[model samples]
Structures are given as C-alpha cells and as structure tokens.
Target chain A: MHAVRNIRLCTKDCLCLYVCPTGATDTETGQIDASKCLSGCRACVDACPSHAISLIPAEFPPQQEKTVSVKNALLTLAASKMDQEEIASKLAETTGNPVLRQLAEALGKSNRLMAEDMLRESGYMLPQSRTVGELLESLLSEKQPADFPEAAVKRLLELVNGNTMQEGKASAFEKIDY
Target chain B: MMRKFVCGICGFVYDESLGYPEGGIAPGLKWEDLPEDWICPLCGATKVEFKEQETVIPEEKKQSSLDEEHQEKIRELSFKELSALCSNLSKGCEKQYRNEEADLFRQLAEYYDSKSSAAFEAQISDLAALIEADLSSGYENANRRAAAVSDRGALRALTWGEKVTRILSSLLSRYEKQGETLLANTNVYVCEICGFVYIGDEAPEICPVCKVPNLKIAQIQRG
Candidate 1:
C-alpha cells in the first residue's frame, strides 16, 4: 500500500512532510510519490492533520465475476440511459433555438456519461482486463457467426500473448546464467 | 395529461405514452393511478422509489416546457439524484467484492457532487454545458486515481471513458458547428448493451467498445 493525498482536503499543514521517513509526501503537487514511499508505511497517513491521506493497495486482486442477475440489471439500466440520451440528442439536433439546443446537448452528454458509468460498473468497459480477455478467449473458441469480428478477437489475443512473451523474456533475462 | 416517472434505482423512465405493457400497466395510465404495491418493471423497485420527472411538461403545454429557472433547478436536482445513484451502485459493487468498481463509483459520486457545485457557480442551465464539465473532470480524476492504484480493470475503464468522452465531445462540437447540415447527413446508433453512441450512415457491424454484435445497436431516429 502507498499513501495518497486528496488535494481537495489538504490544509497545507506540512505535517506529512515532517513525519515521512522517505520524504515521499514532500511534493509540490500535494501528491505522494508512490515510488519513494515504503510499502505499507502509513506514517504520513496517520500524521496528516486534515485526514486527506489514505493508503491504497499497490496491486488489486482480479475482479470477481458479476452474477447474471447483476449483469442483466446493469445492462438494462444502460439501455434505458441510452434511450434517454437518444431522445436528448434528437431534441438537440431538431431544435432551432440555441439555448434549447444547448440544453438538449447537455442532457444527451450527461445521459451518455451515466450510461458509460454503468458499463464500467458492470465490467464491460475493461477490454484489456483478465475477465474480458477470458470472455474474448471463450468467444473465439466457440462457433461464432461469419461476421462476428473474429479479427478483432484475434488481435486482442495476439496482444495478450505478446504481453506474456515479453514478460517471460524479461524474467529470463533476470536469471543469472551459470 | 401524460407525465413521466423515473425509477430512482435504475434511471428507468416510465412514459405514459408507452405504458409498460410488460408489467400489465395499460397505456395512458396515470402514475398516481398505479397500484400501491406497484414496482419498477425493470428493477423491481417499489413505487416509493420512483420520482416524477421534474422538468418534463405536457406536450400540449409546450409554452411551459423547461424555462431557464426550471432548467437550472432540474440540473441541480439531477446531479443530486445521480450522486445518490452512484452511491447505491458503489454499495452494490462492494457487495460483490469488486473493489475497483466500487472505487470508480465513489470517484464518480465525488465528481458529480463537485460538478453540482460547478453548476451552481456557472449557473449552467444547459445540460450540454454540465456534461462538458462532468467529462472534463471525470477523465482527469480517473487518470490520476487509476495510476495510484494498480487495477488493470480500473485503468482500462478510465481509458475507455476518456476515449468515449473525446468522441462524444468531437461529435457534439461538430453538431454545434454545422447544425442541421450535419444532422441531415448522418444517423445515430446507440449500443443497447453499453450505451456506446455511433454517428454515421449505418451502425457498425460490431461495437468497438463492448464487442457486441450489430443486432444490439439500435438506430436513434429523428422525427
């Protein structure tokens, strides 16, 4: 875990600067330098006056698979938001009045953002994540339609495989050849 | 006499014009006339969880349709409501042990809450202006926060959000610049699964973001 500072609540007390053993908190941008900070060392987190700092894990575990019910609910909500966005976009396009058009555009944008948020929450936005990779793998292995974008899936697999190969090479290079 | 009711839990809007026949609710049925035990057909949320669409006025009373004051009020109320929804969603993510997803929701909640303040500051009655501010802050914060945590899923989500925001921003700007000329030439398709918007003559064979087939992409018609 590394300490992070929420600049919003930082009071410029400089307490973190004084107590840090590695001087990771002594930054001009009010953000803790994660590299210099010791692992699990929360001296600054404890000493901060405004409670602006907290420890976040350096590595997060793989996300758990969402239940079918939750996934269905999220997709439904996403579709509903898309419907609202479509209405707002159409209104924006059709309206001649500048103010009304602007308002409609804003509505469309907000609805789209909300929909994207739900997509992220439902685990559909992470194409490069393990779950997504696994999903793509399964899809590719199955009997897919002729127009199922097989090339895209293959490209994704290549990227994953390339990453694994690079990592393997790096580990091999780290070994001391006797 | 038709009014819209929005589900607080899922953002589902029940339009009187297209009454939820799936829920056995007949067309033209007033929201008040619905049974006391009625629930959201989509999410099963109780009647109490449904809020009337605050800014929508009847079509016959077109003159009373969203004025500046009403627009500002609705904008503020919508931010508050969106924040509440984010909070609920974060709790749900936490229940599933999806920490990164939960964190993203918390960040979204913070962004929207802060945006409500920005809206108040700018007195932005226009929804597009509010959304611009939202996307600007959302991507910036997501980039910064995602770096501090090593969640690949969170990072990918943030990157995707940024890309989509950029596309939408450019599209909206083009619409603003060209007006009806642009609208006349192009059609808008929305992905029903993930809400990815595509603007062109036809929908893509597959969604670039969600990878869903074109069947899930529905064209948004302009009347």
Candidate 2:
C-alpha cells in the first residue's frame, strides 16, 4: 500500500488523529503506519489539513489477475523485497527504536504475504455482489481508487447497494497477522 | 413554543416539540417528560442526571416578555435567584472556537445589572454538580476507549507509529504553506524505478524508487 505522510505541510491540529479509526495517523508524529493503512479506505486523505498524504502502489505489473483468487495472489506477494529498507530506515529514524526496524525487516520478508492478504480480504475483491471482471478492473494500480470498483462491477456496486456494513475492525493484514 | 436545548455534555439537542417526552413540555420539569432511561445516547447519562437548560434572566429589563410589573420583579429577583440565573446564563452561553475563559465569565455576569446585588448567591451549587457529572463521566469514557484501543504485545508489533513521526516532521518543518517548500532543507530519495521522492538518505529497495531497476545513489539540493 502507498502509505506516506507529506509532513512538511501538516498542521498538527489533530483532525486526522481524531478521525482515523485505526489511529494510523498519529497527531503527534504525523506518520502513518504504511502496513496498517487500509487497502483503499483513504480516511486520512481527506482528513489531512495540509493535504500532505498519499498512498502509492507496491508492485508494477501486478502480474497476477487483477482479482486473483486467494492462492495465486499469495504467490506474487512473497516475491518482492521492495523498498523495505528505506521505509524501515525512515520509520526507525522517527521511532528511534530497533524493534520496529526489526519488525519492518520481518514484514518486508512477508510483504507479499501481507499484500496478498490485504488483496484477498479487500472489500473490492470480496464479491458479495459483484463479478470477477468488475472487481478486477477496480483495483487502482494507479494512485486513485478513482472510479474504483468500476460501476459495472456488482460487488463494487454493493457499497452503494448493500446495507451500510459496519467497517470491519481489522483489514486482511490486521486479521491473520494477529 | 418549543426550544431546542443542546446538551453541554453530549451536544444532543432536545427539541421539546419532537415528542421526546410523550406528554408535553414542562419548564423546570422533572416529570414524565424525558424518558427516565433516556440516557445520553452517546454516553448513557440518565435523565435525572440532566437538568433543564439554564435561563439567563436578563439584568436591566427594558422590553417586557412579561407584563411590565412582573418584569420589574424578575429584575428585582433575590440574590439567590439571581445567582442561579447567572449560573444558567453561563451554561447557556454559546460555546465558540477560540473563546477565552474570561469572556465566558463576562457573559455570565452580563446578566442581572446594578439593581441586582453582586453579593447575590444562589448556591449556584448546581453549576458545580453539572460540571462534576460531565468531568466524571466524560473522563471515564475517554479512559475506557483509550484502553480498548491500546496496543499491547504483538498488536503493538505490527503498528507503524508513522502518524507520530508525520506530526513531528510537520511541526519541525519550516514551511510557509501546505505542500510548498520553505527552506527545502529536506532530504531527497528517488524511486529506483519510478523516481518518487525517497526523501531520505538511501534509495528504497523497491522501485517505489520507481525510476531505476535498483536505486542509484544521489543527493538533491534546492535549485
């Protein structure tokens, strides 16, 4: 997930802190846990006063099907080392703790696994009401979930169609990882 | 006529006209109006816990909402009644952003003018009670929520604590406006494949260093 904070502009009014469900965005630190950020529930994107935050993508081609079933998706997630070190360094610099640095390293080892988990449980992929094609097209390889869960997709249609579901507490990464 | 009284504790508005109490409106009511179990939906405080909204009886009455003679008597209300009225005035004062504490007191005293004795005392004791309930209940709720969300053991392991750093970085960064560079005293990092700002010393392992296959070492200076 593309979780990064544009710290240079944030005001520290804590509007984001107050609003974030997972406390992913801390009022005091202005850093968001890249790992904990919801797959596409960009709550901080709008709550940010300075507009200093944006989510980026992990893999390039996203080689698996846009909506790969749980199993294949898991394979791709295991492949990349990604920028785990740079992100770890930044986090370590901010936290001044080696535990998170070590944790980040371990997560890097499992980034693909976590990503697959995020994708599998991602509401976009759940298909409670939608088709595979509809779900696949909605994944934002680009920055915006803009036109996300394409209108053609049934499951994508469900947030508008389904009963207002309580947003689940943990995302896929939060679920199994715990 | 019905008035909407907003709760100081929960901001829940009681629109007396809305049949919250099936029977009808009663001023200074403790009757069958508000449901006995109608706790604050947000925090669950009972109806008995709430008092009717405070009325800030005007100080030097010129226009009479009441008959001329009655208005005079209201103005001449004893010190105790007057103090109780002032306490309500303070509660009824509109809460605003950036308002000073002294201004609230000023607004409170603005009621009941020279004819009213400054020595007036109505126990205003109810004021203490309302405040006590709010503090006791409010702080306790906050504590419970804080505990529910507290990260312990491995749950703490997965967290990024990125929010804390982001806040400190913003606080530390000297910028004139959002997204605009002030001194540009920041670090530069490149996506090896994509060229996104690494914003730090070394290149990110993945092409979130998006420009290069593997990152190249580079330094950025303000132009």
Candidate 3:
C-alpha cells in the first residue's frame, strides 16, 4: 500500500512533508510520489489534518458475489426509479410553474439516488469491475445524443480498462452483444 | 431576445447578451458575430461543440416549494416506505463512516420497521432478464426522453448515471462469469463523488462521471 493525497481536501498543513521518510509527499504539487512511497508506511496518512491522505493497496480483492434474487431485486428497483424519473422529467418540462419544476427536479434526483443505491447493492457501481467495461462498450455502440459526453465516457473506459490487464487480456472482456 | 448556446462538452452556456467579456467578446455581440475559432472558456470546447439552448434561469421563475400536491405526496409515504428510506439514509451515513448518526437513523428505521407488520416482500428473480429489460432498455428510454426535453442538468445526470450504472452492471457480469480469478492481483479504488470504481493499483487523476480530481477518489481497503 502507498499513501495518496486528495488535492481538493488537502488543507496544505504540510505535515505529510515532515512525516514522510522517503520525501514522497510533495506540497507543491499536492501529490505523493508512489515510487518513493514505502509500502505499509502510513506516516502521511496519520499526520494529515484534513484527512486528505489515504493508503491504497497494491492489489485488490475480487468483487463480492451477489445472489440472483438480490440482483433481480436491484434491477427491478432501478427500473421503477427510471419510471419515476420519466414522470418527474415530464412534470419538469410541462410545468409553467417554477416551484413545480424545482419539486419535480428534486423528486427525480431523490429517485435517481435511491435507484443508484439499489444498483450499487446489485453490483453495478464499481469502476474496477469488468461489468463496468461491458456497460461502457454497450453505450458506445448505441447512437448517442448530440450533447452526450462521449469523450468523457470513452476516457473513463480507458482509465477503467487501461491500467490493468495487457491489451490481449483486456480485449477478451469486450463481448459486444449489440 | 438574446439567444443562449451551451457547450456540448461541459454544459457551459454562452449567452448572446453577455458575450464572454472575460474572453474579449463584448456584450450585445450575437453568437454568429463571434469568431469561428472562439472556444468555451470553461472547457476549451471548440465553436462547433456549442448548440442553441432555451433560457432556464430558475430565479426568473416563481418562488416557493410549498405545492399542495407535493405536500399530499409527502403525506402519502407509508410506514414501510419510511422504514426503507430511513434504512437507506442509515446506509448512506454508514458509508461515510459516521457511526453515531448511522446508529440514530438505523434506530429510526427499526422503529418504523417494527410498526410495519409484514417484512418487505422479495419481488424479483432472474437477474439477467431484469438487467436486459429494466436496466438496459430503461436507461435508453430515459436518456432519449431527457435528451428530447433538452434540460442540460437533467440530461447530464441521466447520462452520467446511466454510464456509471452500466459500468457496474458490466463488472457484475464479469464477476459472475470469471469469479475470483478476475480479481487475483488488482486493487480497487472508488470515486467518493460519483462512485466510479477503478481496478488498478492507483486511482485515476480525474473522475469520469463527475470530473472530480484524484483527491476525491479513495482506495477500498477490504479487511
């Protein structure tokens, strides 16, 4: 494990610079150099006042398995949420009243959040999971809207699949059904 | 009568009435009058990346959230729903590791759960079928509808949510197909903002969904 810094959360206390033995923590860039970082050492992790620094493992465990029942339940919940989102979206569009629109937006957001929770529980939230790569690929195959953030999604797929597995191994995961 | 144009990339709106004064374009200049080379100040997206949009300034709309229908809807929430909501709230708190508050919400959930006589019924089975019909198709429909409406924020939310959710679904499928061997030596990191998961030894410098910097993504250390 190596210590990493959250630049946004960093208060610039510079305690990590003092606590780090290998000079891995840099205040100027607000980044911790992983190469110099000593494995299992948590000097910066403990010293940071803002709780910005954390240790990340060099290896990760496989995703926990989900039962078929649980998976179906989550999908069902997500489907209902999408329905609610549709209703809220219509209300937001048709309403001449701003207050109603705002309420509709809030309702839509809450439903989306709940749906996300259920989906997360059902094993869809993790970026590292191969299932995520498949999802991105599928989206790419479909014709996106003019304003769709295609580049960001593509960049995300690279970041998700780029670091791990060699080119050949990674390609094996891309099973395009559509 | 001034028009608004939004960046296809970052959703930054360029108004004809306020023509990017900071970028040397003066007020009263129409978007057509601007140079072809001009780009979005926020994300540097090119001129071709902008699309015409309707004005949606909220303050210009009427104030107050006290709609009678909304009140009626809130009143209609049942004990079971309340229990589930409280339980979800408790889980959200727990994810942040806020133990005391999580306990409070969990206690509230139990209180509501106790008042509700029957347990929540198991409503679904056959995960594959639901994923295809509900999640996959459902997302496409929502995305299409949201796009047609042309609400930038709503469209972005749906887009991001669908992308992230699809990723999760793919990962789940992989886990189901390959099992533990797929995770033999990789490390997983999760974006705290948008919940994008990373399987590498280090997290990405920026989150794909919310575009938050690396500092917001944390490693998931399983004990």
Candidate 4:
C-alpha cells in the first residue's frame, strides 16, 4: 500500500527503508509492488512526511491473506517510542545527572526514528490521504478487546492455534474476533 | 548547478535543471519541450500552480508563508492532512534511526541503575509514557491541563510541542475531529451515467452532468 517518496523533495533520508519490514520497498525501482504487499497493512503510509506516499485499497475482491506485519510493526514502534519518551521525561524531571537525561534523549530519538521508518515502509493507500493517513485510519478502524482483554486474546490465540474452548459462558458469536 | 522551487502545498520541488517542458505538473521539465498530452509526473497539480523558480527575492511573498503572521483559517485537519503529518514523521523517525553517534543526548542519561541495561529499560519506559499521553490524550485533556491547545493553527505552528501533538493526531482517527471545524467528512457523489460527482451533501434530483434523475451516487470512498 506504500507509495513512492517524491524524489525531488525526499532529502534522501532513507527513513522509509529502515521502517519497512518486508523489504518490499528496498529495490531501486523505489516503488512498491502491489501484489507483494500484505492486504490492508498501512505501516509505510504513516511513516512518510513529504505526503509523497499513498495507499490505494484493493478494489473488487478483497484479498484473503491479511498481512498483519505492518500493524504489528506500528504497534511495536508506537509502544517503544512512547515508552522511551515517557522514560526520558521522567528521568529528566527526577534525576539530577545530566548523563541519564542524555541517554533518555538518545532513546527517544531512536524511537522516533523507528516510527518514521515504519511510516515510510508502511504501504497503505487511502484516497486524498498519504500513507500515514491510511495507517492511522486503520488503527482506528481495527478493534481490539479491552483494547487487550486477556480472555479475548486467549480466545484469539485459541482460534489461531486451533484450541477448543470449554464450551460454556461465551457463545459462538462471541467467538467472533475483532 | 540547478535551480529549484519547493511546493508548500505538496512537498514537490521544481528543479530548473530538468526544465519542465512547458509542463506544469512535472517538475524539472520545460513547459515547452513536453508533449502536449503529457500530464503531471507527480500529484497532477496542473499547469497553473507552477510559479517561477525565481532568482529575485520577493521578501513579502516568501516571508508570508514561512513567517505566517496571519492565523490560518484552521480548516479542520482532514484525513488528507494526516498523510502529510505521517510522512513528515517518517522522515523525522528515519533521521533518528540513522543517528549512530550518541552525542549530547546519550550523555544526558543516568546509567547508574542496577546495570546499564536496567537503566536503559527504565528510561525507555518513561519516554513511552510521555509519547502515549501525546498520542492518546485528547485536546480537551490538554485543555484541562491549562496548557491544552484546541486551535489547529496554533497547534500546527508549534515548533517542538506541536510536532509531537501533530504526530499524535496523525495516529488518531479522523472521526475524532469534533466541533464545527470538522470537514463534514464530505465527499461528492459522481453519477456513472454522466460521470458527475456531487460536491455537496444532498444529491440533486437532476444530475449535474447529464440531468439524469435519481442518479446513482458514485462510490467515492475517502482514504
């Protein structure tokens, strides 16, 4: 779903290359192949800053295999970046040592870099929006339990691993994974 | 040597070395050399938006955009705007990843934990919390803090704080845009029969393109 960076305005940053998980964007072609892209993943879209990239949804029949790596990458990037930022700020507030503060800042910068890479490599296309727009939209559209209910997660795990439940309390419809 | 002009609206740069062939859409092309039918190589801004890659200094015109003294109308940041934010974030993050030398930043960290490893973990966690707040906390939440900002123009103009906030907004749903500023999330419907997309909320009984009645709404899905 990722679009190509504007060569004229790219600044040759290579952030997109680092963020990409599948290496789908590593070629000299500099453009993504639609067929290799995971269905509905929008990682690279969220990473581009030049507004050069976009995600075009596959029309007609939707693809069966949903490639979730992009989503996974975003979640990890967001979580890690957010973590480093919080840690850095806290250390800055409480610690007196300038060294600790500097380390925190470094961590923060790394998270930001990873997030950017994810956005550049993320390849989802939404109309009138860049790749990042599509990725963020997907984040909202996709649902998670308790945003992370242990039981819900377990059930999903069960589904994925072919585990059978105790057959009580929750109905089959409840088994429907978000 | 090449002369270039950057498009503020779209991050497109026009390089005179490539010389658009009388072409407006494609940069680095001569307006005269291009084929008559050749379209823009980028976003297809058409020929009109291209301004001269000027050598003269038009201080007033140039400063207007960068200085931005006048408050922007603050049109609701649309899903379209999200693209710009995310792409910018990509560039920013990429810059971070490539940073090998831990200069002033690493020097600031406290490495005296049980070990350097633990110290790194603790530090990362704290940073994560700060970013989480930026991404998750609403404008109203910021308002409660007495430092919260609601105006898009003011927020957009921020140097450091708003950069994170804007990035946070990029992660948020477009539906989160509340108040009158919201873009109505509007889209025009186009009739396949005549190929007219209605630009407004209500579908007119007659088609704008073919005057056809009860025209089927064009399935124009917004990204």
Instruction: Report the C-alpha displacement of residue B87, candidate 1, in angstroms.
Output: 18
Q: Model 4, range A41-95, lDDT digits (tens) per residue? A: 5566667666555554222111112123223323333344434444554565556
In order, what DockQ does each candidate have?
0.02, 0.01, 0.02, 0.05
**Best by TM-score, which number?**
3
Candidate 1's residue-wise lDDT over A97-117, tens digit each? 654455455546546665656
- For candidate 4, write residues B58-97 as lDDT tens digits: 5332111212312323222222223233334333323323
Best by DockQ: 4
Against the reference, the lDDT scores of all candidates come to 0.56, 0.34, 0.55, 0.37
Runs of candidate 2 exceeding 4 Å displacement: A27-29, A62-178, B1-223
Docking class of 2: incorrect
B1-223 per-residue lDDT for model 1 (tens digits): 7899986444679888788898798899888888875655533345765678976454331232223323332111244334535554565445434456566556655655554432112221343454465465544443443343344555555544444444455455655655556556656666655445565677777766557788877776554
Model 4 stretches astray by more than 4 angstroms: A1-66, A124-178, B1-223
Task: Rate residue A153 of model 1 by lDDT.
Answer: 51
Candidate achieving higher TM-score, 2 or 3? 3
Provide backbone clash counts, one per model.
Answer: 2, 37, 11, 78
Better DockQ candidate (1, 2):
1
Q: Which candidate ranks first by lDDT, i.e. highest?
A: 1
True-vs-predicted CA distance for residue B163, candidate 4, Å: 26
